[model samples]
Target: MKGEHILPLSQSGSARNTHIEDHLDGSSAAIKVIVFGGLDGILTMFAVVSGCAGAAISPLQTICVTLGTLLASAFSMAYGEFISCKAERDYVESERLREEREVEEKPEMEKKEMLDIYTNRYKFSSADAHDLVELTFRNKDFFLRHMMAEELGILLTEDDMTPVKKGLVMFGSFCILGSFPLIGFIGNFLGESGSDTSRIIGFTTTALFSVIGAMSLGYFKGSYMRQRRMISALMMALNGVVVGFISYLSGLVLMTLFPEASI
Candidate 1:
């Protein structure tokens, strides 16, 4: 213990603050939804376009099909996000209320639990632990918060986004980022119709745009996660390419199996 060099309390607090700031800076529910949701959007649209191209569908038909899938999927993702987040928030709220009830009905037991946590987990001396517990229990709200964190491992923060806001973010991310792959086909369909070369060009452009979008999302995610941005970007792009290729092959097989439906 002589050379352990334990940090002073103030310095330890500052270090914890710095760590929290670094981790929380770009890491929010909305940002997470945007990065991951956008990746989902781009890859899904890319796969859809690849499938249509492999099936030799008309450019106009491809545009229509992709739009249909994009809108439907976005709506589904948004609604699902809303319901799940709402459920989780509700659960946390319920647990907080339950903890408050326990604190009110069983004050001695709650105090004993807090004392045990401080003395056993934090290695506080018995007198210091008792003093800390008594001080904490003086404020009912603060005591409840402490119990929630130490016992339930839940930190209820007002800064958290509402379920509705997160859901809206998800919907927008899915729609806007997901539109990358469909843009090329729409433009090609409007300008030049019914040509093999134009179809090939459209497919090429779609794939390019989708990869860019996926890489951008990955880079943003990497920045927040403190990882190598280029590596993350490349990995995400690779995943999209691999999945899109498989989807394209599946489409080709479907087309082959039902040549009559190709018309």
Candidate 2:
């Protein structure tokens, strides 16, 4: 989502980095996580619900299957996210510890490395790079930070969310957004158990809900990423339609294979 900038020589790289960071700061990160989780939830549930509806299964059966899928998917998504994020955090910590030892044991070597980075990579004059490195070395923490960023290419910053928090967000988003398409299935509980009219209504409601959810996700994504909202919306809607159609076809195939299994 970022483009190359033609910056003047006078501009500091740190300033440009700060501006780039702003795009993902504040509510942006949470928004991103929520959108990601919500979209996954909606699409997955749509697949299941549409599949069941296409198979002409009993409402109770559809409800049972959808619920099972929803809970299973949510837990899976949350746990996977937690482990992935924790691993990343651990790796970063390991790097930090290694860098800390180098800073403490070989201060001069670290200083020279940082000086070379500034002079060569950042295009700082030799004298300026020397002064900057000298100034950084005055503070142990600052030196380590610069080493992490300049030498190791890892920027140290506090995250707004922890791994646990991210997982919880994913679980919540998946459960909530995924429930939308289930509404139609729930309607079957209101009418005669296996009536074709009720089943049709339920499937139609589920399809409508899926479309709305997909479009909403697309709109939010486009707005945050500064893309064309209409195009994004259409793209996401198309995905929903394709998934739903494929799911329906799969259900038809399954039904044909096991005619005796129809409830």
- lDDT values, one for every candidate: 0.81, 0.81
Instruction: Quote each prediction's TM-score.
Output: 0.84, 0.82
Q: What is the RMSD, in Å, between candidate 2 and the native fold over all Cα?
A: 5.5
By summed lDDT, the worst window of 10 consecutive residues in model 2 runs over: 1-10
What would the TM-score be for candidate 2 when compared with the true structure? 0.82
True-vs-predicted CA distance for residue 132, candidate 1, Å: 4.1
Q: Write the per-residue lDDT of candidate 2 for residues 196-232, one digit (tens) a residue.
A: 7777878888889988988988998898878999899
lDDT of 1 by residue, 1-263 (tens): 01111122333343347667556733466787888678889999999999988898887788888999999999999999889877777777788778889999999999999999999999999999999999999999889877777777665554446678878999999999999887776777777757888888888888888888888888988887779999999999999899789988988999999999985
- Distance from true location, Cα of 179 in model 1, Å: 0.6
- Cα displacement (angstroms), candidate 2, residue 36, comes to 1.5
In angstroms, the error of model 1 at 35 is: 1.3
Q: Which stretches of candidate 1 lie above 4 Å from their native place?
A: 1-15, 18-27, 118-132
Most lDDT-accurate candidate: 1
